[model samples]
Target: MREDLTFTSGGVECAAWWYPAAGATTPAPCVVMAHGFSLTREDGLASYAEALQAAGAHVLVFDHRYLGDSGGAPRQRFRAGEQREDWRNAVAHVRSRDDVDAARIALWGFSFSGGHVATLLADGIDVAAALLLCPFSDGVPRVLASPPKTVAWLLPRALADMAGRHVTVPVTGQPGERAAMNLPGEADGFAATVRPDSRWRNEISPGLFATVAAFRPVARASRIGVPTWVGRCADDVSADGKAIGKLADRAPRAELHDYPGDHFAPFHGELPTRIAADQVAFLRRTILA
Candidate 1:
């Protein structure tokens, strides 16, 4: 079953769905889940949360500061730095709960924010495990590898975003929607799995475009002491597989699972449920070992 959780961070009200374990009467290991860029808590995360919860773990799936049901000013804006704080705050909030095991906190991030988990680990979050799903490991390399034409159009807005203190860009659309990841195909793949009744898309801050240039989570993978599981798609064109491989190499304790599909397969069709099951199995071994 699922439940709603509301917590305050930096004076902003944030929301998450807590999936309680079956027959769980006391505190259980918790999985804190977040979505990728242009996505929200409703985008393929609840399935995973429920899977984990069914496996005797509590899953905390939340919307970021400016996305979904969460409270934030100037909605749809993306702040990489602030997102890191949100992750930290989410974990803290979960820790304070009586039904969660504070010492067995794990993080699960997908697509763009898969890279966010690495950043959080680098910042010294005491997490027990990390499950990354098609994460963009190296932001700069991934960004630079994009079509130069696309980058050119985004650079100006990126620059404007850097100086404006708050930047906004259409969440998804044609080629020029935003400079960050989620090009046309990626955007469409993400949109395909939404819950239909949710209003989870809009203009993300141009600040996200600017921030993408400076974010590099792979560089700090060596410092991520927690157990890590990276699930990648062999046919994923949105994220650099080589970059994911490189980050996996740097992680002290890491495992890589290559699936036979594109980026969105792990979140839709017959694969999502399988992927969620696999994720739950991975977390169980890591947290209970």
Candidate 2:
């Protein structure tokens, strides 16, 4: 059964959906999940939630504070620090539930939220497992890889954001346009990830890129000791494969799997099934065992 729910985080109400496992008697294993940058809980994450539920795991998918059905000031904010804290609160809320195994609470984060998972694991949150999908782990390399002009324009906006000036900007746009992601096909690539009936938007706080440039999770991967799974898109332009490989190499318990597409590959059509199967197998052997 699927139930709509909400939890208070940082004094804000965060919307979420709880999918209980079928035929589960005692508390079943649970996986806590959230979306990527500029996306919502229902956008392309429902399929994965269903997949996990079918594999005998309860799933909790939530919208971060400033977007979707959640309540927060200044809509469409993409602050990573706030989102990380939201994650901590989400896990804590789930741990208090009686329908799921508190000791087996795992985390699943895609894209930007992937970095959040690494940060949580580094802090030694009492999670049993974690799965990061095509993670945007290192910020310096990502911002540096952008076109010279895009970087030039965003630097000033970032500065203004730091000076107490908050504004919303396109999260994805065409080349030469001012946006957080503005490569040649970035707009289309991100659009392909959104599901129908989703409440997500293409705009977010202008300061997020600067915050991303300074964030460093891959460098801190060695500190995460959970049985983690890191999935990579082989030809991804959004996230660096080398950085992903390094992240897996540094983590003592992380297992890396490579798929055959870009950043959105694992979530596209039949590919998502393959990815989900891999995750189910991982859990079956580790947390679900």
- Which candidate ranks first by TM-score, i.e. highest? 2
lDDT of 2 by residue, 28-47 (tens): 99999998887898778888
Global CA lDDT of candidate 1, please?
0.79
Worst 10 residues of 1 by lDDT: 173-182
Q: How close is candidate 1 to the true structure, as a TM-score?
A: 0.93
Error of 1 at 13 (Å): 0.5
Please list all clashing residue pairs in model 1, or write none if there are none. Answer: 167-205, 167-206, 168-206
50-115 in candidate 1: lDDT tens per residue?
778778888888888878999988787777777878888999988898988789999999987899
Name the best candidate (by lDDT): 2
Please provide TM-scores, in order, for all candidate models, with all chains considered together: 0.93, 0.97
